[model samples]
Target: MIRLAILGSTGSIGESALEVVRRHPDRFRVTALSANRRIAALAAQVREFSPAVAVIADDGVGGVPDSGGATHWARGRSALVELAGRDDVDVVVNALVGAAGLGPTLLALETGKRLALANKESLVAGGSLVLAAARRGGGELIPVDSEHSAILQCMRGSGARDVARLILTASGGPFRGWSREELWDVQPSQALRHPTWDMGSKITIDSATLANKALEVIEGHFLFGIEYERIEAVVHPQSIVHSFVEFVDGSLLAQVGDPNMELPILYALTYPGRAEDGALRTFDPVASSPLTFEKVDHGAFPLYGLGTGAGARGGLAPAAFNAANEVAVEAFLGEKIRFPEMAEVVARALETAPATEPGGVKEVFEADREARRVAREVSEQLQREGSSRKG
Candidate 1:
């Protein structure tokens, strides 16, 4: 059985992962599960999966029922990392949301466990550090994102030298055709109304801003030995073509599937062997016809270019960008700033923070902190101006 440790067990990806494990019992086993401030949900998971251990990111004071096994509660942010690196875990699935995932990803790679990564923030924040950990620990890293997973499938058997470019498909989000004026008054509810995929709130927001695609581009740079210039994003409302890879000899290969995260989760768990997932529906081209593509409007979403540039640099720059965007997005969701001001805050934070190569986890953490602080300051300044105008 493939022993697995799931980080962020209460989140959307984590739940989907558990469902995959449920479907393929013979191939996968849940050894450990970790969650942040969701003891009740973790308890439910533990009772069902019967994992060897469970770690809670929050203080273990909640009234979580016990599962019929050795369950130990760990407190603090680093608990997830500890759970991920445990000797019992053969594969660590980093499904965490933001910069909080960086440490666990580092530990999983450092401990030489196969990492099925769903958390893009870890790579965007500490790609170099995480890659070095993978190298030192001799562990293989597999991406869980649909786009990266699709690209991974297409690149199989093809030599890295034979690859020409990586093309990522976006769902165009809910605000796909909205002009600048329309986006200025866009509310959080409107942004969260995704057309194709069901995801966590932050990711749905990122989808609307096209920041998710930007993060994926950075992830592609680190996951595959591809350059940022060669990675492109196209708006495909169908969301059928998860991603594509163009060969040097003019062969373009793509992976098409239902817009479900479970397929990628299962692929990561059961690599090389396609398991029978009854949940996945076959793609019907005739019924779901009209697969269209268009160039991304940089004018509508400025964060796209910023993410590409940061990914190209491959240093603390990506970390800063990810951190700033996280803070800005949170502020926007809280109605602290306008939709357009979100990108502006991230751009300002990037301009203020000097990008440098992080020597270790400490440096990466420091850069993330500095970037978040800068983003908040800039966001507050912009919010004050907006309030003044309203007054």
Candidate 2:
């Protein structure tokens, strides 16, 4: 069995991964599970999988429960990284939502475990570090994102050099054609109601702002070693076509599936191999008809361009962008700022950030830390200005 340590087991992607394990019991085993908080959910999973270890990442928040099994409890954020580097676990699925995932991701690869990565922030904030970790430890890094998974599939044994361009698809979120003026009044509730995918609140907000696509573009850059200029995103409301790859000979190939996380999740677990799972075989081009595409309106969703531009600038700019966007998304969800104001906060934070190459993970974290601080200040300033304008 391919033993797995699934971080963020209580999350949307994490739960979906457990479903995959449930479907294919002979192929995969859950050696460990973790959550930042949510003891009850983690407890429920532990009862089902009987993992040897369960970790509470934000240890002080949740009350620990009786394992009622052979499971050992681990506490604190450090436990998350420890779980990833465990010798018994063969795969580390980093399903975490934000930059906090960077620690476990680096550790997992550094320990020579295959990393099935769902956390885009891991790459967005520390792509170079992630690559170096994989190289040093000789571990495999497989992407869990639908777009990246699709690109991997389309390559079909071809190297990155043989490819000319990569085109990633977007669901257009809940605000597909919304103009910049229309987004000013958008609320968290509406943004959370994503038209295509069911995801965590933070990612759903990123989807609404098109920041998710920008993060994905940066992630694809590291995952496939593609240049930022060659990695492009388009608005595809159907969400059937995950991504496209155009070869040097101009042969464009696309991976199409129904908008479900399980297919890509399973694919990551069984790379260069196919597993039979009837539940995930939900692709019917006839039914998912009218496959359409359009250019991303940077005017409506400025975060898309800002984030992609940060990726192009290289160095720690992408790290700063991801961190600032995380703070802005949190503030927006908490009703501390309007939807459009999130872009303003990120823009201000990015402009104020220093241009520097992170010599190591410490520098990336420093960039992330400073960006978050700047983003919060910008958020507060925007709030004060809004009140003054109204008064």
Candidate 3:
């Protein structure tokens, strides 16, 4: 059985991973679980999974080991890293969203553990550093995001030389057809109503704004060793066909399924060995009609350019883009800024912050901090201008 360390157990992806483990107990074991907050949820997960170690980002969630066994309650992101690097963990599922995921991912890779990566921010924020760790430690980094997972499956039959380009599909989100004027007036409630997938708050917002596509574009570039130009994103509303790969022979292979996170989670757990969980069902074309595709309107969703630029520019740009987007997303969710302002904040920060070659984890961290600072400053300026107009 593969001993698993789920780093964001309380989150959506982590919960789905735990669900996969629950279905097939003989195939996988939950050795460690970590969460940022939501102590109740973490505690509940601890009780159910009975992991050897349970970590919380906040100090308040300490001194509670109610589970009958000896459970270690670790706090902070450092504790997450420690849990990820433990000798007992054979696989580390880096599912935590945002920059918080980078450390645990680094630790897992440094320890030569199989990293099933769901955190797009980690790759967007510190892909160079993470990839370096994988190279140095001889660690295997597998993509857990459904689209990337689909691409991975499609690439199985051909060599890298045969692969021409990778097409990453997006659902175009809830605001896919909304006009510029319409987008500005969009509230958080509307943005949160995703058509295809159920996800965390931040990601849900990202999807609506098409910033999620930008992040994925950057992620695909890193994970596949493909250039940003070679990577393509199309607005596929159906979402049945997760992603497709084009080969030199002019054949396009697409991985289609019933849009479930469970398949990816199970694949990450068992990897080379396919589990007998009976979760990954086939894609029935008859029921799922009309897999449509369209070009992304760069004018409407400006974050597409920002995200694509980050991947193309490489180095610190991606980190800065990720940091700024995280801050902007949080601000938008808090109602501090309008929906259109999300892209505005990220773009403004990207302009001010100069790109750097990612030297190590420290370099990426520095870039991330600087970008967050820049984004906050810009956001405050926007808020102030709005107040001044009212006055």
**Reference-based TM-score of each model:** 0.97, 0.98, 0.97
Candidates, ranked, lDDT? 2, 1, 3
Checking candidate 2 for backbone clashes, the offending pairs are: none
Model 3 is weakest, by summed lDDT over 10 consecutive residues, at: 61-70
TM-score quality measure for candidate 2: 0.98
Q: Please say which candidate is ahead in lDDT: 1 or 2.
A: 2
Clashes (backbone N, CA, C under 3 Å), per candidate, total 0, 0, 0
Give a tens-digit lDDT track for model 1, residues 187-239. Answer: 99988889999999999999999989999999998899888878899999999
lDDT of 3: 0.87
- What are the candidates' C-alpha RMSDs? 1.5, 1.0, 1.5
Off by over 4 Å in 3: 60-68
Q: Write the per-residue lDDT of candidate 2 for residues 143-164, one digit (tens) a residue.
A: 9999999999999889989999
Report every candidate's CA lDDT.
0.88, 0.93, 0.87
Angstrom error of the Cα, residue 154, model 3: value is 0.5
| Candidate 1: residue 373 Cα off by (Å) | 0.8
